[model samples]
Target: MKTPVIHLDVDRLIQRIALFALAGLLTIGLSVLGFHHWQMSDPYVRAVLEIEGDVSHGRAIFQMNCAGCHGDSGDGLVGPSLHSISAHKTRASLIRQVIGGQTPPMPQFQPSPETMADLLEYLETL
Candidate 1:
């Protein structure tokens, strides 16, 4: 009777584990440095109202509700371009439009006051 011997490749296994570790570290470093990109805001959620808001949440809300009509960068689409809305219209007006609703083809949004203000902050950045 004969027994076959099995050998383990320890060096190759170590190299593979090291490669994975390096990849993980690189990913963490890139994320910390914001190599991830596409983040809407990072300036500590700058709010401009008496109330408070988060720029990140506002950006998400805008993408979901506004971008379809207003364009991603506010360059305008079905709705008017909002790049300079702050300069053209007052903050109150913007809030009103968001809460109350505009003319035909423009539906009203029921976002909270905080959401509205956050959205305004994001628009200002535009």
Candidate 2:
């Protein structure tokens, strides 16, 4: 019986290895970029980091205007839970909700710009 000879393409193997390395690097780079962008673009994160209102005053406003429906902790009552309001809503969206008002249940509130800003800050604390 005769043994057959096997051939190996060393250059092709090296090229494949290099290609895989490059692809891995590219994937890592893109993932890092995406993660950084996600953190910066998060509405809640930005809301917390930026200072536009007085959280203490905002707490007063919340108790006065929102406690009836949202509960003391915003854990919800007649209204939906607002404990994580910033996570789900942007400051602009909140402002609109307060000013424009939603249909039924959620009443229309015309808070001054300062008050609205304070409210947003208080919400971020929640």
Candidate 3:
């Protein structure tokens, strides 16, 4: 008895792999967008974002609360450097990070929305 040999189409296999890779990347991108949207939609985040911020007051707030860890100029000390942090993180993310205190060694700071707005204004300047 002779056994039948099955041949595989290498081109088709490559195409299929590429298609799956593209689909996976699309899924990940959509998920990230969705998560960001959700974060932005939070009531507290929205409220904080709505308030106008005062840079001078914001600087004072940072000096009082954040200067110790983040350094006077937002340079890294015990905490990571926040220079251009606004470029790296969205306003919503920054709000959550400050209030959530998910990162250890950083205590949770639940300031009023106006105060948070002030702090955010100060951070943007760095």
- Residues 47-72, model 3: lDDT tens digits: 99999999999999999999999999
- Predicted candidate 1 versus true structure: per-residue lDDT over 17-116, tens digit per residue: 9999999999999886673242224222223345565778788888999999989888989988888788876665566567667665889786656787
Question: lDDT: which candidate is best?
Answer: 3
lDDT of 2 by residue, 1-126 (tens): 989989999999999999999999999999978866766574554553465799999999999999899999889898888887788876656666666668469888876667777888898888
Q: Which pairs of residues clash in candidate 2, taking residues 3 or more apart in a chain or in different chains?
A: none
How much is the lDDT of residue 47 in candidate 1?
Answer: 30
Point to the candidate with the largest TM-score.
3
TM value for model 2: 0.58
Q: How many angstroms is residue 110 displaced in model 1 relative to the true structure, after the best TM-score fit?
A: 1.7
Q: Which scores higher on TM-score, 1 or 2? A: 2
What Cα-based lDDT does every candidate model obtain?
0.72, 0.79, 0.94
